[model samples]
Target: MREALIVWGGWPGHEPEQCAAIVAGMLRDEGFQVHLDNSTRAFASPQLSTMSLVVPIFTMSKIEKDEVSNLSKAVREGTGLAGFHGGMGDAFRDAVEYQFMCGGQWVAHPGNIIDYRVTVTRPDDPVMQGIGDFDYHSEQYYMHVDPSNEVLATTTFSGEHAPWIKGVVMPVVWKRRHGQGRVFYSSLGHVAKEFDVPQMRTILRRGMVWAARE
Candidate 1:
């Protein structure tokens, strides 16, 4: 059976523990043997490379250099990496190398907890197939994204929230590669309750599966 490791912890504001539970349930339903951990130190395990996927639900925390090194090496050698919102996008701010692997960093959420729409850019992609542009109610993330990311969904910023970026179209979901591993990230899910939204949940589920080593 494919194994997946989920390490969740950090700022409680993001509900990392709750979100991790939801994700763990999702993976179990998909036939993966899931391991749930509450500390970033889990990344330091020598067995990390044996897992098929690594889901980091950690946000705004410091990761030890050895732990980060091991985690990055495991992914580079083919373990998959996938996450959503600040869990993955806002994690380990001091580790630039980790940020480089994630492909984007959460810089701001203008007009926090507001209504917005997500537009599918690559509906034909497996990760986006059958999904349509949907209205979302949460923090609309403004990120510093890697240009190489294969953007799957996007959102347009109206001047009402942040005037300077009004006409800007920001990537809401994207997939990329870190060495031999598949990396996926979504800038949605400010809190666990947001998972009640079908579009939000579905996109995340599919993204995680897609990021798993095949």
Candidate 2:
């Protein structure tokens, strides 16, 4: 079976395990051998080299140096790395190296987490294909994104109360090429129920498929 590993922990508000399970099912449906571990300890093993993809469902927290290195190296060698919202971008907040690999960090969620719309930029992309436009009544994230990314979709800060240091247009779905590996991220997923949305499910699944080391 094709292998994919999901590492989940940190904030419980995001329902780490549930969200991981949702993604796990998506991966499994796409013919992957999925493993779900709600811990940061898995990063201690070089066993990661055997997996085709590594997904971090973690929130704002610090991770060990060796764990970070293991994950970073795995992705560099062409293994997939993908996640959404704080689970991916906001993970390992205190580590500079982790942030560097993640490509962006969640700075804030302005307007107290309201509904917003995300527009697909690269419609021809495999991950973004068929996902024209959709609205998410969830936390609209304001992030500090990396310039070296192929932004797939962006959402504007339509909420009036947002403290956006950046511009109105912010990216929600993006992909980056780091070394030989493909890194994909989305700034949605604040709620575990996000997985229940058909469009969101399709988008997340497509990303996983694109990121997998096929």
TM-score of each: 0.98, 0.95
Tell me how candidate 1 scores on lDDT: 0.94
Q: What is the Å distance of residue 142 in model 2 from its true position?
A: 0.4
Per candidate, the number of residue pairs that clash is 0, 0
lDDT tens string, model 1, 1-214?
A: 9999999999999999899999999999999999999888899999999999999999999999999999999999999999999999999999998999999999999899899999999999988899999999999999999999999999999979789999899999999999999999999899999999988899999999999997
What lDDT does the true structure give each of the candidates? 0.94, 0.84
Give the Cα-based TM-score of candidate 1 against the true structure.
0.98
Error of 1 at 126 (Å): 1.3
lDDT of 2 by residue, 1-214 (tens): 7799999989889888888888888888889999888778787678887788899999976789898888888888888888998899889888887788878999888776687888989999888777789888888888898998789899887547744343488888988877788888988788788887877777778887888788
Give candidate 1's error at residue 165 in angstroms.
0.8
After TM-score superposition, the amount by which residue 78's alpha carbon in candidate 1 deviates from its true location, in angstroms, is: 0.4
